[model samples]
Target chain A: MKYVLIILALLTVLTVGFVGLRGQTSRQPPVMVFNDLVDQPKYKNQGESAFFADGRQMRLPPAGAVAWGRTPDKPDPGNLIDDADYYGLKVIPLPVDAALLQRGQRVFNTYCAVCHGGFGTGNGVATNYGMSAPANYHTDRLRQVTDGYLYQVITEGKGLMGAYGPSIKPPDRWAAVAYVRALQRAGNAKIDDVPQNLRGELEKQP
Target chain B: MHDRRLVTEGIRVSRIFPKNSRQIAAALGLGVVLFGGLITAGVTYYFTPKYTRVGYTPYQPVPYSHRIHAGQLGLDCTYCHTNVFESPHANLPSPNVCMNCHDPAKGNIKGDSPLLAPIRDAFKTGRPVDWVKVHKVPDFAYFNHQIHVNRGVSCVSCHGRVDQMVEVRHEQPLSMSWCLDCHRNPEPNLRPNELVTKLDWDSAKDWKVSPLTQNTDSQEAFARKMVKVSALHPPTNCTTCHR
Candidate 1:
């Protein structure tokens, strides 16, 4: 019994000497025990390439001599509007419906509402920093503009604004235009514009 | 071979070992087995990804705070990660996107600050900033941000309150068992598709609880309805993620 007790005490001391707990902050890379295809030898998206002079896999080639598989990018049927029509004060190609307005509201809240106020009043949270007054849709200058003109400005940004053409899809841009028009109408609505039944409720507000 | 017992009986007998020599040898053998088990348990606990992958906070080349940008500023996740709804990968924002607000001549919010030098340099020199990706599953496991975000899995579900994290940390293990835990039962982690980006969204407080829209008093019923409506069948088959 004494020998068994002594052996157990010695084993406990050795076991406690070298073990540390898990989930501690580790700056070192995790050692992979099963690295089956986890680290593949291939080019991934936006990966650096030592073979290129610029070390960028996504950069434009430096004066490459050969050109192949190039197609003339003009008047694609997928765009649903021609370049001339899009720039020539064309109407919105998509159907103007509740669904379009809802989509417009969502996209506007995500992208535009950061600078433009949620209500398009040019008083967003960004203005609290250093941004100048974003264009207020309530102003006569923006209210009088053509729908195509608004679309063009959004696609190809004007003076201070950056072009959203790359980030936002074209359909969402049209939806935002429709939503901007809705905000303008909602801003300017008078008592007569309200439904006859709901006018009493509007007047009842304190 | 002689009568050694008679010969040594007169002298004081000395034993090289104790009287309990058999007991000591048996105890030593048992100790070896127990010590081996302790080492095995310690290795299983401390050496796997469950321990190593969590709490990994690598120092980024240029530090950016998700807490200030996403939490305090209230910038939506999609504002920068624009392709999550459409593409499998949630793309990192190009430097031009950063320059929209950080340009020295333009929006000019801390534009000249030394902290923003890397962003401005990338914008001018056309080289990408080396932002270390923190939360990554192994290359073998395929994770689609589009499918998860659109199906009402909030970023907080897997990432664990990223808006609150000043520097990104690997909050979850990202092991296959961790992924399977959610894939097996995802009701508690789900919300409406509309509010997926709102990190702190709560159905009881944020959503309207009315039977008219079938957003009933019970939040579980609503989440189950969402699963049925979206037809979410998260596959547990081998090829689903490994492929």
Candidate 2:
């Protein structure tokens, strides 16, 4: 019994010693450090910084700032009106590109059509949900506005309309503006003024 | 013979009584101690951080060095990963976008480190240059790069020193608390409206440019300015972070 007691006591002491050592060695605090580059410096010239970063500075390339890669002599379809101020607000011009127009159409269908109706008649799903009726693109007020003014309304957003600038890319926004103009023209086109190629098709209608 | 018998009797008594009890008790006690010790050790190991492998480290494609681009070149994170301020994605620039400059610059280089090779291959094959994502949170965690970037959170806040890193590694734990710390209290680095568009300012010369230069009194004026220019948005509500 005495021998058993002595053995048990020795085991207890060894176990306690092991645990004590483990406790002494196990704890560590996580290390956190801040970067100085982001902290101290402000970048001055974007183009210079681009070059310094081993990237090229595109200054007066063959194509202008708006022209992605179209030929200069071809009267690049991407160049639209350059009037900046329209309706007392600074306006961004829409690029005259088919692809951009298509992209803009897609974005409009996804985000705007739900609120402004697919044809921009102001009767969207949100209309029943307390949103005011959006202005119809076919209206004389919108048709009279320049393409620049339309671009501004789309970029900066008019009253009761949120800015689509953040939601859509600059190019895509321009495309949407083009599509809006297209919609307006389609709505206002006279039956007799239909294109010769399409007059036969329209005349065939009952 | 009697002495021998007595000696035998003494030996039996010593061996049978105290010694046997001691041996049996010692075995039982040792068994209990060992079993108890194992249980304790197992419990401790189970609760310890060392045993858990929640830390994820995934392998990437292309070995694109952020250190060379961001650190050495001093390129802004927003340049390539454009739309970080206005959109949800800190989008990887398209291969064509990369080729825009690289194609013209390195026309002479032929072999590896030819700067334009990856871009050329992408253009020729029509396959996108697949970049491995480093800082991926779970799908359930809806994190917007725009809100954080616009609201004064530096790229290094979550991405760590990406410019300095040769290989981009996930540095932050990227837990909810990590996001909330900044969301709850935004920094003063919130950029002004004009500065937002004019991203390539020469920092050396324009170091003293402050967002709050115009002095307009009244809370309404301040509010209007904030709405028009400041990047300060609301907190991370359920819809803000989750949706």
Candidate 3:
């Protein structure tokens, strides 16, 4: 009888211990409940603020203050996009290297590819959303527009397009511009653009 | 004679209290059984997945069904939630964005329906539709939609089968441990960057060779390679989300 009582106590202890461990595994309530900022009363952009003497959340930029990383609007002498005709200045203002072009390709695919298709044909999936047909980069009309014109359009949106100035930084924007030029050049490339050996091999194909 | 009578009386008194060893054993048995039953019930109740708001389908202003749009017509998640890839907030679409397709000027596809009256009124008045936000994490826990989307996490990763949901509900617990499960090893959930918006992207059905490299490697291999090459460095430190 003594042994049976001892066994029962041991069994009870084991069961209680297991239950305690299981309870520990369950989620404990956080020390403080989550403070939902969205639901909190706050001033939105351009919204009225009683807290501030000036009734607006957005303050005007100081005079002569330029945006971060943007060069002055005045064209630099060495600037490749300055007064250059479309096909005239083939060279990129920034150093042209394999890495720069590769980086440009990535940036272009992320931002520009939605409106201008992945292959620059302007038949993006965004067309389904009732967006007006984007211009095809392969056309001679786009090919004739200078690189500066493309940069400006991207900076200050043209036609139905919204400005991407805030989202894409200046350097990345230039990279996208470089990528656009590469796409056009590739679209209009001749057989001579291929290596001499590769051209012979291509001609061999019946 | 007196001693014998006293011993017999003591035994009889003890029997009145506990009856016999059989009765005492039965009472102990009952106590053990009761203890076991309560403990089992307690563990099952506390540990059940049903506790963490699983089927909490809240009613919205407009009964916009993801089932018809995403499942039937096969509209991508990105069509409406435009900034999922670029911003932390998966922005609710303004009425003008909705008007692009369902404008009265354009063929009023479903415009006249009473269900859409609120949308029409908001569009006409330029007042925004009050969309009820689902799947909101705690304000203190920072979740960046862009980082996850860009790093190859799909919509279906956290929002299980959103395409099939008629009315979206909270599926995952969104708990700290639930998040840590993915941040620890994110290989299985990862996909190619282009397919981030594609909620139904299964690696098994349409496997392709890696275009990133010239060599012929499986898509899964490509994803694993990307995890390394991108140097994803998903921080496990507390400050990553808490701060």
Write model 1 residue lDDT over A109-135, tens digit each, in one string.
988888888999988888888888787
- Model 3, residue B52: distance off in Å is 2.1
When summed lDDT is taken over every stretch of 10 residues in candidate 1 chain B, the lowest stretch is: B209-218
Clashing pairs in 2: A42-B203, A43-B201, A43-B203, A44-B201, A44-B202, A44-B203, A45-B201, A45-B202, A46-B200
Q: What is each candidate's fraction of native interface contacts (fnat)?
A: 0.49, 0.00, 0.02
What TM-score would each prediction reach against the true structure? 0.86, 0.39, 0.59
10 residues in a row with least lDDT, candidate 2 chain A: A23-32
Please provide, for model 2 over B129-230, each residue's C-alpha lDDT reduced to its tens digit, 9 standing for 90 to 100.
545444544445567777655654456556656666676655665666666765665443333323432334322334355433334343344434564576
Q: Per-residue lDDT tens digits of candidate 3, residues B1-243?
A: 999999999989887777576877787787677667766876565444333344556678898899876776566575567567777877666565555445555434554678887789887775555565556565567788999998888888888888888888767767777888888878877777767766666665555533433353665686678778998667899998987
Output DockQ, candidate 2.
Answer: 0.02
* Candidate closest to the true structure, highest lDDT: 1
What are the per-residue Cα lDDT tens digits for candidate 3 across A1-206? 56655776686677667544321323223222344652356544234456655444545565555555545673333233333232243445577677777867866766567667788998765555555677789988889887767877766566656565544555566788888888998899878898887787777766
- Highest-TM-score candidate: 1
lDDT (Cα, tens digit) per residue for candidate 2, span A76-194: 34334222333343333444677766766655664566557778777765555445567777788888777667767665666656555444555666677777776777788788678
* DockQ (0 to 1) for model 1: 0.48
The alpha-carbon RMSD over the true interface for every model, in angstroms, is: 2.6, 18.6, 9.6
Off by over 4 Å in 3: A1-122, A125-133, A155-157, A160-176, A200-206, B1-51, B56-129, B144-155, B161-169, B189-198, B203-240
Pairs with steric clashes in candidate 3: none
Q: Clashes in each model (backbone N, CA, C under 3 Å)?
A: 0, 9, 0
Best of the candidates, DockQ: 1
Task: Output the lDDT of residue B21, model 1.
Answer: 74
